[model samples]
Target: MRADAQKNRDHLLAVAGTAIAEQGVEVSLRDIARRADVGLATLLRHFPTREALLDALLRTSFDELTARAGELETSSAPDEALVSWLRDCVVWTTEYRGVTVLMAAAIEDPDSALHASCVTLRSAGARLLARAQAAGTARGDIDGSDVFALVAMLAWLGDQPSLAPRAERLFGVVASALLTSAGGS
Candidate 1:
């Protein structure tokens, strides 16, 4: 790809980042084009459809998340690291409600970013869970999917800032329960 094409793609992603996060995959391409200060033709030249743009954004965000999870896994105590990651996950999900909604849709599509994202996040979850369980600090029965579910709920709650304090309390309870050693063994 030439430098100009790359530059256009990058610019599109930047504009799409916020738009997609706010409006979701169903957001108008024309709106995105306008926001980027580019024409609809140029926008389509880079991303053919809303789905493609969404897939790219989801791919970019989740990939970064799992990568960060990897770093957290080896950097500290298992329970502490998992808690830290959960906090980070809440923040990320809350940032873009559109992306959050798109992720739900993508997971249903066969060739969506959700499939790859699941694998990535799951691997990170496994590593983190393993360490926590090994140290008797986390429940072994906690599945990777559970963490995703909690994250999704938190993301949805982000829209209602009024409920933040309540959500935080709920999150603390659930996280503590998940991280505590099961059966007191």
Candidate 2:
């Protein structure tokens, strides 16, 4: 693509990501094109289909989350790193319910790029889980997939404002349940 075309495509992806996260993965291509101040043809040129656009959006999110997780690895405290990951997960779930759901769904589809992204995240999450488990700050039996499932449920719960307190407590509860210690947990 040309420079301007690439710029427009980038803008469309940004708008589409925000739209999908806020509205749904089911959002129309025209809707994203309109939001991006681009024509439908341009949107189509960038993302040939809903599935393709979704794959791109999920990949972008995975990039961000993975980068965040990578940064956490530099932290000296494994427990703190786990907590940070949990917090990041909660934020993603709460703010982007549709995208979060999309992410979960993507993991189920073998051919999806989103599935590839999930694999990367799952691997990183497993490493973090191992660190915490080794430190006795979390359960040794916990699998990364379980963490994924819990976060998916939390994301679904994120839309309920009345459940704000419970929403906030969800991560802590899960963390406590995973911990080997009694008092601190």
Candidate 3:
């Protein structure tokens, strides 16, 4: 990509991220282009589709989450690290309205542009989960996919206006249930 094209793409991604964060994922792409002072054609040229644009916008957040998981793996106890990273995953997935639903679908769609990133995000959680299981802090039966599903469910709850208030408490309950030590053993 040329310098100017790369600059345009970066600016569009920034504007789109803010727009989606503030207005939900349904924000108009044309409006985003206008806000970025770029033509709709140019935006399409860069992103190709709404999912592509979203994939680009969210890729950085996923990468950061993965990196944070790596950091927590060393800095915290296995259980604490898994819990902390799962909490962060919820926050990341729920950053934009409706994003949780998009992610739920994207993670299952091998052709989605966001699939690889989502997989990486889940793998990060999986690493922590494996460590916790090894330490006997978490349930031995649960795997990374289960952890990912739980995070996605929490995020879905976060996206619901009526359920938002209880999401944190629910997360705590679910987290406790998944922890082996919480069984009073």
Candidate 4:
């Protein structure tokens, strides 16, 4: 891509990110174009679709979270790593309102633009969960898919106005329940 095109793309992504964070993943594409001071045709030429735009915006963060899970696997205790990754995912999901729904759907639909990133992210969390389970630190009954579902649930809780205040406390409770040691040996 030319320097100017890249610059325009970056600006669009930045504007889209802010719009999604403020309004949600479903925020108007026309609004994003207006915010970026670009024509709607320009935005569409760059992104093509809402999913494409979201994938472009979120892919970097997803990659980082996946890499972070890998680092935590080697650097932290199994249970600690799992809980930390879980917390990070929930926090990230909450930042983009209504993203959990998309993530959940994307995970189930291989054809979705977000599918690959969501799968990789979920797999990263699963590895941490598996490591904890192997060390007898986490419950063995739940698998990676369950962990993914829990992340969606936790993020959803964070999105709820009535439950937002209790999200941190509830996260602690959920994290504890995931770890066997938290319940006393």
- Residue 156, candidate 2: Cα error in Å is 1.5
Q: Which of candidates 1 and 4 is the stronger one according to TM-score?
A: 4
Sorting all predicted structures by TM-score, with the top scorer first, yields: 4, 3, 2, 1
* Global local distance difference test of model 2: 0.75
Where in model 4 is the C-alpha error above 4 Å? 182-185
- Judging by lDDT against the true structure, name the best candidate: 4
Q: Which candidate is the best by TM-score?
A: 4
Instruction: Candidate 2: list runs displaced more than 4 Å.
Output: 182-185
The runs of at least 3 residues in candidate 3 whose Cα sits more than 4 Å from the true structure, single-residue gaps closed, are 182-185
Candidate 2: Cα lDDT at 138: 74
Q: Taking the tens digit of each residue's C-alpha lDDT, what string does model 2 give over 81-120?
A: 7767867876876765466666677788888767888878
lDDT per residue (tens digit) for residues 49-88 in model 4: 9999999999999999999999999999899899999999
Better of 3 and 4 by TM-score: 4
How much does candidate 4 score in TM-score? 0.97
lDDT of each: 0.75, 0.75, 0.89, 0.93
lDDT of 4 at 161: 98
lDDT value for model 4? 0.93
Task: For candidate 3, give the lDDT of residue 185.
Answer: 17
